[model samples]
Target: MTPLPVRIAGTGVHLPPDVVTNRRLAETLDTSDEWIVNRTGIRERRWLAPDLATSDMCVAAAHPALAAAGCAVRDVDAIVVATYTYDQPLPSTALIVKEALGAFRALTFDITQAACANGVQALFLGSLLVRTGAARRVLVIAADSASRVTDPEDRTTRVFFGDAAGAAVLTGATTPGTGLLGWDFGAELSYDVEIPAGGSRQPAGATTFADRRHYLKMNGRTVWDTATRCLPDSVLNATAKAGLTVDDVAHFFLHQANLNIVRAAMDKLGVPRDRAPITVDRLGNTGSAGVFTVLHKGFSEGTVRPGDAFVVSAIGAGFQWGTLCFRA
Candidate 1:
């Protein structure tokens, strides 16, 4: 009566056709392409088209995953999408994706608004469903269009976000330690000092518009300090829980939020720089899609192998941070 293992059967991604390059943005902001590239390692990123939304990208990405898994959407028992930027206000993107994928039997829901950490969070949650025998298979999708939240006038924020979606199918198996080994989550809610004019507390209005409340605002320095301090420990803790050391992990799939942040965490964790798989140079930060986007890149390039150990981690909105250790 032992529990089953959760195995990732497939991975897929969808990036909008539009490419927003740093050079293109440099034409608007006071920043230079070199600065953005040196700091973030992002030369260009995908942006959702005017007609597309998070659900659209998720649905598109899900199709390939469903195909790879060799199952119809109806075979999934659950759907989970991790994103704060949904196409609509109600009904959840999970349901949107469910209908989009023609999923009929799955229970659907969304997860934390923890910006970049979401992809891994969604994956970890989906694993629980299969591991507990509550689900035969689950669809975990993370998609976001941060272009709307970014303030075009703010050089720092403007160059950091883009749009993309990634999907994974987790199926139940009789194998041991094949999927998620362990995960750890941490939060610093006091840093909830977000732009106060967008939500119910201060609904968007003329006054809010005047204050530019719809844009994403953050205590960037503070978050940087916290991430530099918190992220490594989260990785270490999760690795320890998984009964592995930093050296034991073959590839690191840290959040692709920024080049500096990833380097800092690898330095702090004492993991070699080359150990991490990265894609920010071309994808920017896809919010919750960051981890899987990198995962997809690695998979597409045939670099990831079966039995390879990996460390996936992130820190973002809500000042949340966490990590998951898994085997490919």
Candidate 2:
């Protein structure tokens, strides 16, 4: 008997055409390009038009991945869309993506309120389903339209976010450690410190709108500090579970949160700066799409190679954090 394998068939990414530079942002906010770049490593980011939505970018990314994998839309057995921003509350963004991609036969579902780490969480779940015979080819898409929740006057988040999507196709295989090797997940619910008002606790209405609770808010210093201390341990834990050392991995894909966080985590893990792949400088923080976008950029630029072991780790709201080890 052969053990089922979860192999990544293909990867794709999509960024909107609108590029919002820090210099451009400085025109309205009380901030400068140097300040934003020095802190976040973000020079610019993509933004969608007012008419465009999260599912639009997701479908765009998924189509290329499906084409690259030589699989038609019908070949997808499941579709998992990781997003905090949705086109609507009901029917799910997953169904919208499936319909747009023409995946008439796919089992589609949405994973919501997952910030930067949502992509990996979706991948982990999709991989398990494939390895367990629950599905065959699963399309995992991470997308965000954070501009909707952003307050243009608030320079902190306005300078850090952009709209984008990324996708990967996971399929059953016969090889061990071919795709996801191991995963580690942790959440500090004590710091559900960031939220916009669309919930039972604060339903959408005129009062909430007046309070501006529907816009993004954060304790940046707190989240950054927590991420620095937690991410390296998450990486180490995942590597240990997969029976590999940190030195054994070829490429490290950290979430594109900030330059300082990456440096701090690497210092803690004792991993060299040269091993990490980063794209926050040009793409900004793409919410859940950040990790996969960086990984895709690495692959395109020849930073990643075949048969090489790699690790991807992310920390964000739930206050969630997670890691996934893989063989490329």
lDDT of 1 at 321: 82
**Cα lDDT of model 1 by residue, 1-328, tens digit:** 1223667788899999999888899898998889998877889998998887889999988988778778787788999999878876787889888887778888997984777777878888888888777888899998889997889899868898889999888886555557677778899785442556767889878999988887888776876788888889998888888888899998888888888888998999887899888788888988899988877776666777888778778877887888888876
Q: Clashes in model 1: which pairs?
A: none
Candidate 1 local distance difference test against the native: 0.83
TM-score per model over all chains: 0.95, 0.96
Q: In terms of TM-score, how similar is model 2 to the real structure?
A: 0.96
- The candidate maximizing lDDT is 2
Tens digit of lDDT per residue, candidate 2, span 1-328? 1223677777889989998888999999999989998888888988888998999999999988887677889889999999988888887999988888889999987877658888889888888889788888999999988888788888877888888999988887565556677778998784434666888989999999988888888778887888998899999998888888899988888988887788889989998987887788888888889888977776656666767888888987868889988886
Q: What local lDDT does model 1 show for residue 322?
A: 84
The C-alpha stretches of model 2 lying farther than 4 A from their native spots are 1-4
